[model samples]
Target: MSDVRTPTALPTTTIGPADEPATVGAIGYGAMSIAGTYGAIADADVTAVLDASIEAGANLIDTANVYGDGRSEQLLGRYLAGRRDDVVLASKVGIVNGGGIGKRGIRGDRAYIHEQIDLSLGRLGTDHLDLYYQHRVDPNIPIEETVGALAELVTAGKIRRIGLSEATGDELRRAHAVHPIAAIQSEWSIVSRDIETYVVPTAAELGVTVVAFSPLSRGLFTDSFGPEDVHLGGTRANFPRFQPEHLGANLELAAHFRSLAHRLGTTSEALAIAWVHDRAEQLGARVVSIPGTRSVAHLHANFEALQLELSDETRAEIDGYAARVSGPRASDPNWVSGGREGLI
Candidate 1:
């Protein structure tokens, strides 16, 4: 493990139980990349990133069972051995990855959810998850049945709060009716604003915190990203936005966004996160951003965005970039919540 370089603590935010809420760091750590979602990561680097996140007060660690086929959770389990209580642990179920192109599916049936929770708990080495999400909505299973299973976990003390990832406004509403949803995790960044059309408004009305994942557009808003980065490995290479035809146009737009960040005396990645925080406030919704990184320096940099304040004008300018992007948010719209908007 590497030593922590910066130890600045992030500000706090509240996530709901409706009956009682829990306070957690405003900026959380998303463990996807550490498990090779972006590319292969060394065990040492993963340890350092996890260590740095907790040291800097970004203790809200989020992961999913499908991430590296549960390798991410196992690594976190090792790290949380003696100090699990010090962190706000969250993980998700659903979305089985078959390890090839177009070989995945979502399952939210009671039996599957029940089986996965135990596996998640065993791998995480924790008896309970602070927040558990339905990684993706299962088209075959009704949202009500899925949420009902999660509600049972809450009763069993396996999960403290319920969350739905990439769920549409209607899906969120239906799930919330079955049981109070503490948060809705989705991709909400400079380029992905479709959620603002309906999901954000619904979450705001229900008083559910919007946990913004990929707030930096999965590195598109960062300095290191480029058209050639697609070959570096992981699933991002297959995303439509990074494909040959759309990459150039998106890169040009990112250049302008990066220039704006440079003028503001901040990294494009940090500025992108600040934009999410600012926009959430403007939309009358509470948000916590979980930006994943394999580097400790990047971890510290991500949490530093908590102190950033963006002006109304600047936020709108950043918001404008969303319109010019060239591809759909996902290769298959059906894979994300926006695609399943009207369906159950």
Candidate 2:
């Protein structure tokens, strides 16, 4: 029984050079929940959540080919069957799972490329995808080869725009050279601010908008975690970032964020998102936050974060917290994504 807030009038927000309208209502639907990231959810329940997200002013929906072994796209497609045109649907490919072979990696071969798109389309029940991304780099494939193939898809009217995820600045530049990238989706939460080094700058230079995922530090910055909280669950249990031994130090850093967020009269989630939103804008770039959630209530909470602004002091406090965080912010050692990239 998830609570869904009704869509209220969204404040006028500007979009960046290659991005969509900055504010498309509040909150966006994250299809990963439907794929059972933390726990299993009935397909009907996922549909209800999707529709609930729409009712809550969520027009942007995020999903991937790997999510639920492609179930998210299928379910989302089935869920949005009649109203596909009403939403901005985003799906990603790459990360080829070679029939459970350790050969699992990315594939951009023209034949494979076309095949994956067809599969995603069939699953999503859409003629074209609004945004399509390469989920990960195929150490076996060249960026030029991959982006070139994707560019052809755009010309064929199969996709509206192109984006890259978990990519380095060099990787992004290479992709953008082949085609004008619309967005660059990545994990850019307060804890995963590694992108501030080059991804943000490259996006600004290339007229690409940054779509930030995990804007809440994978729930660490929410009201739940504290200096004393340490039990980790899900696959994160194996991650060094969430290891019980390191929990105390990480919690201490999160406290700094909590204090600053409180002073600003906003949730840490709100403060974190606002920092990215405002900073990107100040740099003459547009940014969007797409925090994923299982409950529509959480979605609404994430969306409302955009309404809260951080003053200079609050922003500075957040930077201070970032500096104090212990260990890598992302689920570390599980995978290497082009080095300091992705939702760390």
Best by TM-score: 1
- lDDT, each prediction: 0.86, 0.69
Give me the overall lDDT of model 1: 0.86
Question: In terms of lDDT, which candidate is strongest?
Answer: 1
**RMSD, each candidate, Å?**
4.3, 5.1
TM-score of each: 0.94, 0.84
Tens digits of lDDT, candidate 1, 224-339: 78866777655776777888888899889989988987887777888888888878999999999999998987776676566567776776677678779888788678877777
What does candidate 2's lDDT look like per residue over 1-344, in tens digits? 11123434543332223344334543466677677664667776776677777776677788988887898888888788889877788889887766432336666666777889999998889999888888776667887888888888989999878878777877889888877777787777666677777888888888777777777766678755653333322534444556777767877777777776776566777667667776777666556677666665665666666576556665555666666666675443223342544434
Model 2 stretches with alpha carbons more than 4 Å out: 1-8, 11-27, 97-104, 225-233, 329-344
